[model samples]
Target: ECISSVSLSSLIAEEFDDFPDAELILKPISDGGDGFLDVCRFHFSGKILNYQISTPYDNSELICPVLYNIDSKTIYIESADLLGLKVVSAEFRNPLKLSSKGLGELLLKIENDVSSGKININKIIVGIGGTATIDMGIGACSALGLKLFDVNDKEILAIPENFNKVEDIEWDNKTFPFRIDLIIDVDNPLLGRTGAATVFGQQKGASESDIVILENGFNNIRNFLQNKDITDSSNPTFGAGGGIPSLLYLLLNAKIRRAKDFILNDLGIGRLKGKVDFVITGEGAFDHQSLMGKGAGIILQEFEKRSSKIFLLCGIIRNEVNKKLPDNIFPIEINSFFQNKDESILNIESGIRLACIKIKNNL
Candidate 1:
């Protein structure tokens, strides 16, 4: 699923080839992560609005896609398109310097377009995940007209590196004119050991010292919010997208929902519960973390509730963490056939097809 769109498509094609007479239903899912927009595009009829936006590094440009659904008057935006770690080079990846400003710019452009009658969007659903920054939404808030000032009454950029310098933050509610819904996969809070920077900063290329700074930055922002009477910083979805949902919840009154639940409800999965034979769900990797509120894990839970057999096809299976898989669940790992991660990903289609063939012949 991470390598190419062909992985899922190839899986479906092979599944149909294996069971020509059986009815096959493909429900591609994402945990509001990297592939979220693709899932939305496949299921929803929408027009894509492309705009030149800043990359996470703040030095380059990316043509970000926003899906505007005509039927629901909703606009779908994926944060990864703007601030994804993949957008930045591995050598230069640094959470301290990266910003979510591109996200803000996209939102502002959407709002302006709506205000000018260019689009009739009333709802904004932002898929927040797979981001590169740990600024706690400061870069995004700045783009939405939130001003941060230092002790000397000088304006400052709200990046993680400058977190300790921010003395005050200000914003105008009238700037944003749409109902915001944040789609999140994880339920970690905004503060503490399991919080944004502490849990995810290292993956975004933050060093040990950088993580300490990032933690302090998040704490500073938390303290600032506390002084403003926004004391509830322990919300479950706050840690998602580098605590972007937390800021959106505090400032924009955004509603939070698990991406799997939201997508399942939207796809009317409840109606298909008993009609389906078996459910096949997966992601790039399967591990203990996936069970902790991730989309694939949630899908597995749903299928289990319906008493359906489940097959998990993943690139890698962390046996140490995923040792307690359910009795009715079967896990297929493609790592055994390849020598390395890159090779495994490049040959994912063949690996999955082979796995399907074995399963079909065995059954």
Candidate 2:
């Protein structure tokens, strides 16, 4: 029911189309999830290479875009394109049967291209967010040459359903050809109350019983990897993308970076040399989590230092988060302008324009 950042920015721009003697800069930010590729395309002049990758639910494939910055020799990948929850149908959202195999396939394709001299690359930056599976990336590892076997030494598939059947894990010793940087949106450990399984499993359509299965599966695999000294579940960033980063960290030695840093610094949001006057940022909902490394919180922190007059607009704002706002930042909740929640979402375009109009009048 929420408007996209791009659409919101346009609405704001149209409202301030004739403002007297002022410049308007539109910067649409993403948490490296659904709109990651679009945001990358917006910021950088690069080639978009599309490849058919497997879907989250089955073996079928879809074309996903990969951004390549020629000058920096960096390749940006949005994990959600191949294995995001939004791509899967509501009925097929079960993590128990899903696999992250598509992600591995894409990575292998990129590696093959590099090895064949088709493209030049020094770093592969993956935005890991909004994934559907919680198999601890066993499925992806399988595609990348990680093998699993049962107690009888018989090999088995590396899916969540086969986790309990797995007795041994074998790595093909395949190393990534380039530096791997994983960008995570949330800071959650792989195992605990706020871990991947407990915190995000339900939203992916996992039931209470299914969550138990997933948590147990993750624990089993974690212990196996621990014996080999490949990975530790204590790292909070490992929880992003249903534990995909954990296995990547173990196998590819991927470095974990917060979305705030990657999106702001590497993507040029934090690299603006000139003085910025005003900044307007918002999210679908502003809550405690928004303050914890989310885009809006990071934007607030970044612009607060510049003494810019900031306006934080959101569909809904929690009272606790509102109280904690800085003195320079003004909070605008769209819901307050509507008769009810339904009306606000249905007429979100009007709500955004009204919010911007209010901001202009205040100035």
Candidate 3:
């Protein structure tokens, strides 16, 4: 659950070697993020819906979940399926044209279901962390109903290679039974230096030229919205889904929320208010950026409120970051004692086992 496949697979192999004949039932765990989709499968009471959808790079199909939170009157959409880059190929991993239509299709499915059941929906919290393309928000709109036309009044088929070409949008959105809350994990703005195109483009294989194209396209989308007669949604969740949240804001007028809030409210974490003793967490890396809206920072903050003992593990712990750890917590860098020059997997496993051993000893 808290372990990556690389680390998990290797860990299993090591356990088998040590025991030689142990019969073990292995289970995976997630730390309240994308992993929750699989871990909480048994608890979900709604119908499981799957659909054929497009990727950010090329058109394809992805399967996803349509979670209905009855108590809160919300529909929870897990984005790990369609738009997550972990599933898309490198050549097909274009964030510039990534659309949340797969997500849209899921929500629309839920909407029809809930509507038929006559269940009132107050919110639609779309968890957008790992995604493939970055088409602002037009892809989802086009997939839904709105027509994104170019100069000739013909609909724009693929990702917007350039922004100046967008002519107009005709939205015939059916009256949604409820509002939408696009829960984005990152804080990058819609465009510019610290925005989506620049901050996340490189990881998704967008070059300097691609970033420029995406930025200019986003700008054009912005201009189109400003001139529209309807309400302006430029200031919405423009940071999520490579600014897809903001795109939804302008195109579909969705309410925005932090991913943290979605988890907090959904989990009712306050129930753990005076019951915890120690908290342990780990991640791929730790740095100054981890302090800003990252899962690590958020976990530490929540634990701090309870004055819980926190044990944190990471693949690498930079000197500057170690200086910021609070006294009650143990922050360990797996690299100090072990270094495998040839095998990164071995290095990661040694790190995890070492960190777990330290925590086990401490407890």
Candidate 4:
């Protein structure tokens, strides 16, 4: 069996081609990150509202996706459009300078559109992940009318490097007319060793020194919030989207939900229980991280609850072969078919087809 999530439509098509006679159900999945809007476009019949927003790196404009459903009075926004790493150039991928201000700007724009009768929105669903900043969402809060000041009572810019200089935060009393739901990809807390900055800072082009700065920045915010008795710094999923969820939870009273749960519930996956014989799911790479409540892992767990067989086919498997997995669960590591990573990746289509064929024959 073979399956993929997010950016693997071509791969899924190829798999279908190989098993033309087999009954296959194709469901494109996302953990509220990249490719979220693409999946939402398929499920929701809505108008695609486009807005030019500033990219994470500089003043470059990016056309962001906001789905407006008139029937449900809901709006869906993918955070990656404004905060994804891909929006920043490789040479300019510095988290310290990046700000999530664009996200706030987009939200305000949505409100304006709604107020003008251009769009009807009562609830805003934001998919938050694959971000390029570690500013603890201070940048976004700044745009949302939160004032950050330095010890000298001067306003401080909402950037990662300036987080440590924040002496107080003042709210502008601005409120959105719609309720907000933030779909978080990970369950990591906002601060600590396994937190956002420590785990994801490097991927955003942060050096060791820069990581420490981000960590300290996050700590400062946590301390400030805790002192006010507004929120607990140890909240899980607080670290998602570079601590975007934490601030949103505090400022907007947004509800944070697991991306997998949100997707499954929205799609009505419970109806498929027992009707489906097997479930196949995979990602670009499978490791301990996949088990960390990601889309694929959650899919597996969901199917397991239904007592269905599960097969995971992935480009690479980082876990040891001897590692224990569920009894009915089988993992097909496509990299094992080739001598090296390059060769395996180069021939991914062939590998997936072969893996599916092998699994079919074995069963």
What are the per-model C-alpha RMSD values against the true structure?
1.9, 1.9, 5.4, 2.7
lDDT of 2 by residue, 29-97 (tens): 877767777777777768999888888678888888899988888899988888887788898998899
lDDT tens per residue, model 3, 1-363: 235533453464454455433343322322323544543343344544455555555556666655665665665565665677767777666565556566566657667767798556777666666666677766676667866679988877646574557888677754467787666666677877778787888877788888888888778777777777544434534756666777577656677776556444544443554566666655557888676666666667777668557777766767788887888778876656555423444666666666656765675
- Model 1, 1-363: lDDT tens digits are 445432485566666674765566766766687877877877786999898888877667889988889889999887888888767789668888888888788888888899899999789988888988787787887878888889998998778888877788777774467898888888788877898888998888888898898888788877887898877887877889988887778877888988776767875655677778777777678888888778778877778757557777788889885678877777878777778888887887777777677556544
TM-score of each: 0.94, 0.94, 0.80, 0.91
What is the lDDT for 238 in model 4? 91
lDDT at 300, model 3: 72
User: Which tens-of-lDDT digit does each residue in 131-249 have in candidate 4?
Assistant: 88887777888888888789999988788888888888787656899999999878888888989889998888999999899998888877777777767667888989988988888
Q: In candidate 3, what residue range of length 10 has the lowest lDDT sum?
A: 24-33
Give the total clashing residue pairs for model 3.
Answer: 10
User: lDDT of each structure?
Assistant: 0.79, 0.84, 0.63, 0.79
**Candidate of highest lDDT:** 2
Stretches of candidate 4 exceeding 4 Å from the true structure: 1-21, 227-229, 305-308
Tell how far residue 130 is off in model 4, in angstroms.
0.8
Which pairs clash (backbone N, Cα, C closer than 3 Å) in model 4?
none
Model 2, position 352, has a per-residue lDDT of 89
Candidate 2 segments exceeding 4 Å error = 272-274
